[model samples]
Target chain A: MEMTMCGIVGLFLKKEDLRPRLGDLLTDMLITMTDRGPDSAGIAIYGDEAPGLKMTIQSETPDETFAGLGDALTVAVGAPVPLRVADTHAVLILPEGTEAAARAFMTEKGIRVMGTGHAMEIFKEVGLPKDVAARFGVRGMGGSHGIGHTRMATESAVTTLGAHPFSTGDDQCLVHNGSLSNHNHLRRSLTQKGFPPSTENDTEVAACYISSRLAEGASLGEALEGTLDDLDGFFTFVVGTKTGFGVVRDPIACKPAVMAETDDYVAFGSEYRAFANLPGIEDARVWEPEPATVYFWER
Target chain B: MRTIDMATTPLRDLNSTLQAAAASGEGQWEIVNPKGSHAVAVGLDGPIAVTIKGSTGYYCAGMNKAAKIHVTGSVGPGVAENMMSGHVIIEGDASQYAGATGHGGLLVIKGNASSRCGISMKGIDIVVHGNIGHMSAFMAQSGNLVVLGDAGDALGDSLYEARLFVRGSVKSLGADCVEKEMRPEHVEILRDLLDRSGAEAKPEEFKRYGSARQLYNFHVDNAGAY
Candidate 1:
């Protein structure tokens, strides 16, 4: 069987001063893995939380879709809504308790919500890593932690929705490397449990699976550990929450994964090259992640 | 010494340069800043010595012949896969299928090796100083696999003719694989392989494993085993 290789990278800064370099370092890491996936790329950045909730939305026709969207949303919710447009995506900041109202409005307007959270802002597109990073100006943004993925679309179509860093929970996202064997079955089960997956991508199912586990009062570590038993197939997943970064591989560990940690930060990559050029990497403790073991760091 | 810097040069150019050097019978090459590139120093036929300074991605030093390759860092899946002849040494851990279906070579891993270390091997000699993952030597036709540390589940499934030696515990044996007596001849072979691969484990500390010879031909008595 031919495996569709993808690339996953994550960085959690342990030092406050290094926060400004997160996007720059992550961009280099994602671009180094361009050969691993050529179809699409996505990144989720965890930055400062505004006074309200931020929802990222994407559109095929941004000019028509985003025109006067802020005023229209403000009118619908009877609250001031601020919208920031980036190439094909827009970030809408709404009051704390207005997520459901905003989501309903988006559904009626046919605008696709990519992710919604207090701290996370996601940007993804169907293009090379370099172009996608440029499209969103990822290199200029600053964050404390972030996760990125380059997709080589095997299970789903090559579209913005199919890109990774799939967010199924507030302030949470997941990027996966290998395919799931029982995703179709698990997808139906998850849908019945009220965590309905929206994409045909198996990785979306995995994201929702983790989100549902967390919703059941499982810690991030416990949720990742559950994957070893419930998720059947080879996978190396890098999951990020508002305050933690976690990594886990399948029991067989058919995919490639390596991690490096320094006093300044902890990093995960499909291969070592992704973090090889990061600051203070020369003295970092680099090792391959043990199979079926969950490694996570929380701030 | 010829040096190829992956930081400044493209992968294709580096591979073509190595191919040209091999054609001229030149030896002693060094790859600086490999940066996890895949398929480095592959398909070399001449007796050359290549040292990769950093880690590499999948299929590094693959399909090699008459060359000695050394990687200072770890390697990804299928390292030395389908190799015909030569010595490939990894200073760090190796990913899955370390020496899959290699016809001939001496591949040594100083650190642990992931699943399928010597799958379908056809005459290659592999030595791992550390543990190996599951399904190792599966469907192995002919070769020698030496594991100084423990082996994971289903070791040597559907094995054929290949000799296996493990110094540590095996979680479980495969359908057609079982423990075999370590005769003086087997001891001699294990010692030779250990010496060639530079493994420090003594031959006397090892135990031999091989096919049970029941699955060679279809028989109703062995149908359940299959």
Candidate 2:
């Protein structure tokens, strides 16, 4: 398996004052774990919410795909749809009640939609995590919470589409560090349930699973707990909602996971080494997350 | 005192320096800013003391013949694995499969140890002041595992020969593993282990577990357990 199989990191800020530094801190943590996986990397930031909606899209040829995209959306929405470009991904600020039309417009133009929400913006590409992060200026972006993955690609190809932080619902994303033995079967059932995963990536099936659960009114903790029974394989999932960060590991927990929480933030890493540079980490309550347990933090 | 700063020096230099230390060399060495690096002081055959000021990643002190190594922070997977003869202490928790397949040594963890703490251990003496995770001591052939707190699921599954001492309740026992009477001799061994590891639990309050030796010969009827 050429795998994006290791190095998962997340940071959830409890102190609102640290929001501006979330990306910088998470970037440092992500870069520190470079040795775990180097095939591809991705990040999902629950940053400041725009007035209407934020839809992030990625393309192989950004110069042609992104040019005039904002102007075209503005004409279609009958309002200015502000755009921000970072590397191969671009975020479009859509006007209220225009998501369906904009979705159709982008689809007709054959655009790859990454995620949609007011606060969540995702960036992923096929490269080393440090280089990917630098290309997107992840160090300068500000957010209240974010999760990142550096994949090694064991079960699938090392393509941008196969990278993690899969977003199946607005403001919700997931990063995984293990493979699923029953992803094909699970994906079939999920597709039947209207949560068809867009990629062959196993992690995307899990992301859709969470989104499907939340759409059915299951709480974040309940959705995470559901994973233990329905999913079969080794996994350490760090999920992010608009205002929440949740974690769960398989009952076996063969894949490594560690967490540290302080008065300011809650953090997760596949190893303690990822937390070495966080401020006040020496005083943080660092511990190993228990197997088959769901740990959630909301601000 | 010799101080090695890993932030400025690569891990190869640190390990080579320690591995090259003369067997007669007896002095104190300190490592700073380990930043969760792996194999910090592996394959040491000297008589010296090294203190790591921070936490470490995988295989902190593997195949150690001599040299006492201590860590002030938690460690990742397989800490002190296959140690020959020495003392390795972790002030914080240890990740998975610590001290696996060791020939001889004493591994002490003051905090909890994750899954399979001493799987397939040969002759290492491990005393954890905190709880140990699931499937620990599985198929362990020899040596002793002492836990002060509870053990997770399937303790000593398919075990062999290794003696297990737990002061707290066991979640469940694995196949062919059973609780044994803590005879005076067992208590003496436990006492010695507690004393050496500086753990303060009373030997009288503990229970000993070992293999039933039913699967030793691998009969067809016992094949299911394997």
Candidate 3:
């Protein structure tokens, strides 16, 4: 009855050189929190973007779905669309300004887009954190910042799409550690507003809500602040954008959240152990994020 | 004193090692480099002492009895949860639900404790040196919760026979929780608790809060209150 529903981690590298170690460090943090959530795990990495739009997609049957998909998309779009496969997920790179066409093509092909952004690629699966990370080669990747989640599946099923790091907007994703009490009501409203959530996970509702706020030109901090008033739940959300990392907790602050900042980076975890092995953590300024407060860091 | 390095030893191995040592009558242990591991030194029943050198994750000393545990750094959620007896001390801040559902024992947080501290406590004595977050001691059945600093919203909601003391302001009190007069005996009890917990605050500077006994039993008059 007292089970913690999930674990979330985020890291923003202030020093550009540390970008290459983003996935490695995030994997360590994510795996360290295996005790908090054991059902499934996911990660969203914000690495360097290619010359055009990039969308990460996942399929249960990767072999049959991904084979020669890039060549077919290239012929359909009349431009080069390079595809790279990793386990059940693949990243498709499209020509500049061809996101809509590529998306339409993928939709016609019955592919599920996990996330779409110039710099972000999401990989998630239903398994332990370590296995999921290994299967996706997350540790070998590099990025400027990233967020990860291990879920215990309180509200929905434990499918690959039901995992955390739900994305509803370009270069935007969110990982949540608490359940939302008013998700059903909020989801209906969001769907009416043209930001329909693709999954039943409450975290997806939160992601769409923030994306809608950002679409209205609110800053990342302001959007996160809006959650304190608009959302009714006990949640600790860690969000990743193209250029920033942000965190916020509900008013009650029942879910655990700890943040550590050093000269080189800012790291967040549901517990201190997630970032204990990070370099310079012993000297990092560590503290708990206050209730209903928004903390964001940008390069 | 025995030293257990958690970096080399797995969490289960470390817990089993402590259990074996406690069974062998070892009176003291020094756990080095905990690195925020959960459930450290849990379910121990003996007059033993455990000093964790670094921060710990959730439920560090859950269901403990007769063991005096001290952590030099902050603790994750549910530290000393369901504790039956003995004392647990955290030199740094504590996460939510510290000492939740505790039946007995003393829990001391030298720094701030987050929300739901001592929630549903049955008979535990909790002393917090700094502030505590919202909804602390909710539906508490018995025992004492003394806060040297401020208390957040709904300090004691649906309380039952629990003695709550706060030196600073209370955001709000939940149903059945009311401010009570601090008699001489109350002051003495608080003084003893503060002294035992090594808190510097004076008992005379505190205000007592407890249940108002309005909704203790089923009654037609309490329908609106419920």
Candidate 2 collision pairs = A1-A154, A2-A153, A2-A154, A3-A152, A3-A153, A3-A154, A4-A151, A4-A152, A4-A153, A5-A152
Clashing pairs in model 1, backbone N/Cα/C closer than 3 A: none
Docking category of candidate 2: medium
Q: Report the error of model 3 at residue B53, Å.
A: 1.3
Residues A1-299 of candidate 2 have per-residue lDDT tens digits of 22434799999999888888999999999988788888888999988989989999998999999999888988887899999999999999888998998899878988889999999999999999999999999999999999999888766677888888899999999999888888899999999999999887888889999999999999999999999999988899999999899999898888889999999999999988899999999888888898899999877
Q: Point to the candidate with the largest lDDT.
A: 2
Report the C-alpha lDDT of model 1 over A123-153, residue by residue, as the tens digit: 9999999999999999988988999999887
Would you list the rank order by DockQ, best first?
A: 2, 3, 1
Better-scoring candidate (TM-score), 1 or 3: 1
* Candidate 1 chain B minimal-lDDT segment of 10 residues: B17-26
RMSD (Cα, Å) for all candidates, in order, is: 2.9, 1.9, 3.3
Of all native A–B interface contacts, model 1 reproduces a fraction of 0.45
Total backbone collisions for each predicted model: 0, 10, 0
All candidates: DockQ: 0.48, 0.79, 0.67
Rank list by lDDT: 2, 1, 3
Q: Evaluated on chain B only, what is the TM-score of candidate 2?
A: 0.95
Query: Which pairs of residues collide in candidate 3?
Result: none
Q: Report how far residue B199 has shifted in candidate 1, in Å.
A: 2.7
lDDT by residue (B74-154, candidate 3, tens digit) is 899999999999999999989889999999999999999989999999999999999898999999999999999999898
Candidate 2 local lDDT, B38-107, one digit each (tens): 8899989988899999899999998988789999998999999999889999999999999999878899
Q: Which 10 consecutive residues of model 2 chain A have the lowest summed lDDT?
A: A1-10
